[model samples]
Target: MSTPAPPFSGFPAGALSFYAELEEHNSRDWWLAHKDAYERDVHEPMLALLDGLEDEFGEARMFRPNRDVRFSADKSPYKTHQGALVGSGTVLGYYVQVSADGLRAGGGFRAASSAQTARFRAAVDAPASGLALEQVLQSLRRGRFEVLGERVKTAPRGYAADHPRIETLRHKELMVVRDFGAPDWLSTRRALTKVRDTWRSVRPLVEWLSQHVDSDAATT
Candidate 1:
């Protein structure tokens, strides 16, 4: 029988260095030459990390290293960073990425359709659910998690510029992120603890979306 993959022991320092070099030499030849290091330092570590996290976070997905350049102006052949999603399937959930910058973890709906956006806005407009969401955002902010999302300068079509929950309503795609760039603990088992804590903190936000937004759309 095949041996089970070992538990995550944190990412190696080389993972950061590899990405730092990739940022400068984002070419096919550079990538091909250093592919072994990518596997040893970056890819494998991520897989192990995800495996360690699966128990608490459920199945996770490792994104491809290749960037989709078909419709983009900046056609970089390869992505500068590696990323993954946890507890996600057809719906949005948690995300983590590592690069020269180090680690980033957060959660939200990324590609909410117009219908979904309408539903999200509706939930935010209601006093009970909207207030609950605001509380969650405030708590995350208190914990220093950065709230990020695409938004309009003014209010969305139906919501007033003066609306109380306009900021939340204006979000086309909402996510919260914590960026820990090259911390000393990054290359140790502490990385696993840190990531788990962060994801747990993000759970309420994810649950809010699931309960107030995704659940209905899922069945339809």
Candidate 2:
């Protein structure tokens, strides 16, 4: 039996200004200066939420906030957002990305150090992985998906070209599993309930895909 999701009541506070502050300063120096507030007000609460989730799901993990930005030219010292997971092992926990808009849920199950983002992109494009991809797309199609950031112009798969969520999809790497439609204001209890409900709905499809993939692998 899957564990019940944590209560939504435990969600972090002051997330909007935290994101705004990061964007406004947009530099390592500024983050360093404001590090205490960021950790106390933003990181700690997020970690607590993750801890609650981990207690329920048995495998969610939070990545350390110290980002490795040495290879990139952008040089932003801190992540503009935060995240956590609810599953275990190589298959990452159901992932969540928190920004000024709210909390969004999706998968972030990648293993490679160098090509993690690329693999996610490929997964979205892969016909075999389309089941997971389609679940999300269908939600967006039904207008159930919410855009957390500023609205944009492009539509998702089912919507017309001018659909608002399109812009959010365009800004982020759409293939990455960070597009789940959770709202930040949702209480942790409610969020957990929704997660369980969603997982129940999708589990059969996920299992079918797993079996199919295994059979194909054996044949190959």
Best by lDDT: 1
Candidate 2, superposed: residue stretches over 4 Å from native:
1-8, 88-91, 108-184, 187-220
- Backbone clash total for model 2 is 10
Which pairs clash in model 2? 7-188, 7-189, 8-187, 8-188, 8-189, 9-188, 9-189, 87-93, 105-180, 154-166
- How does model 1 score by TM-score? 0.94
RMSD (Å) per prediction: 2.7, 9.3
| Candidate 2: tens digits of C-alpha lDDT, residues 59-85 | 555655556777888776667777665
Indicate the residue-level lDDT of 201 in model 2. Answer: 43
- Overall lDDT per candidate, in order of appearance: 0.85, 0.49
**Which residue runs does candidate 1 get wrong by more than 4 Å?**
215-220
Cα shift from native, residue 213, model 1 (Å)? 2.7
